[model samples]
Target: MPTKTLRIPTTDGPADAFAAFPDDGKRHPGVLMYSDAFGRRPVLERMATELAGHGYYVLLPNLYHRHGPAPVTELPEYIGEEVRPAVLARLMPVLEAHTADRVLSDADAYLGFLTAQPEVCAGPVAVTGYCIGTLYALNTAAARPDAVAAVAGFHPGFVVTDAPDSPHRLIPGLAAEVHLGIAEGDVTPEIIGELTRALDAVGLGHTCEVYPGTVHGFTMADTDAFSAAGLKIHWDRLLSLLDRALARD
Candidate 1:
């Protein structure tokens, strides 16, 4: 795999990002990966490289570039239970300030830069995210269905919120196949039904199920809630969705 640091032009400013791709000199399907509220770090970089090894061009960007590059705030190498509260306390204001407008602006810039990469093939791309990035991934897919062929989220957050602009409410605009791997107790049954109904309303092929015996943020290795089994399932679901949607070789 080959990886490179990048600067992506956006409405707010140049976002610091990274790209991971196979070193085969062949253009591959593009995948726009959104990081969780934790943002970019070594864990995410390794994940991107692993995905790129499967024959796709993966672009991971710093969502809070307006404030600064990733680690917009200092972060612990491991976000364990003891330090989780402090991290969230420091990050809450910054996370809240990232409005939907900013999300859309960054999405456009990310997709534009991703599809234009020399290593990326010309076609609708797939978007995948973890935790809060699920919201970003869903928004990007809905806002540009013609350009997003698949959208998958794991241990997702804020997808079934009461807000009018909730991820579920954006289902009508999606033309892509969807898959959401939920964490146990993270989402209630009633909310799951609501999300299912919303996706059903649009006749979209989708899956929204709780991965067994896992807690929120199960897919993130550095978190206290990390579950190796859950992470394996996440990769299975994600790769299947991307392969079916993007037709990568």
Candidate 2:
């Protein structure tokens, strides 16, 4: 596999990004992978490479690009119990700074960069995200339904919120098949039912399920909350979803 450090021109500035593809030298389907609030790091790069090995061009962009390039601030090797609070404190503000308008603008820039790549196969692609990135992935797919064939999120919350612009509100706009790996206890039964009803109401193709025995951020390798079982489930669901949604001509 080959990984390249690149920049994506956004309204705010040039957002740093990375692209991973097979070394076999053939164009493949494109996947825009949104990083969690933790931002980009070596672990994310490895994830991108793994996805590329499955015959797709994967692009990981810095969600906090407006602040600066990835690792906008130096991230620790592991966000252990002692440093976890401090890491959240540093990241929360950056998370709050991203307005809905900014998210929409950035999504356009990311999609533009992915679809335009020479290594990416032409036509509708796929999108996947983690943590709060779930919102970004949903917004991106809803915004360009014809361009995104599948959308997946892992341990993503805030899908069903009191906010008028909640992610579930955008379900009707999405043309892609959607999958969400929910954390245990993240959402109440009523909320899950409500979201499921919403997706069903729109006749959208979607699967939203809670993974048993998984806590929030379970798929993240660098966090103490990481669960090997949950991470494996994510891989199985994501790859299967991608295979079904992005089948070649």
TM-score, structure 1 vs. true: 0.98
In terms of lDDT, which candidate is strongest? 1
Error of 2 at 174 (Å): 0.6
Candidate 1 residue-wise lDDT, 130-181, digit = tens: 9999999999999999899999998887788778898889999999999999
Error of 1 at 43 (Å): 0.6
Worst 10 residues of 1 by lDDT: 240-249
lDDT of 2: 0.89
What are the lDDT scores of the predictions, listed in order?
0.92, 0.89
Candidate 2 residue-wise lDDT, 112-182, digit = tens: 98989888888889999998888999999999998999999998888888899999899889999889999
Alpha-carbon runs more than 4 Å astray in model 1: none
Runs in model 2 with CA error above 4 Å? Answer: none
lDDT of 1 at 100: 94
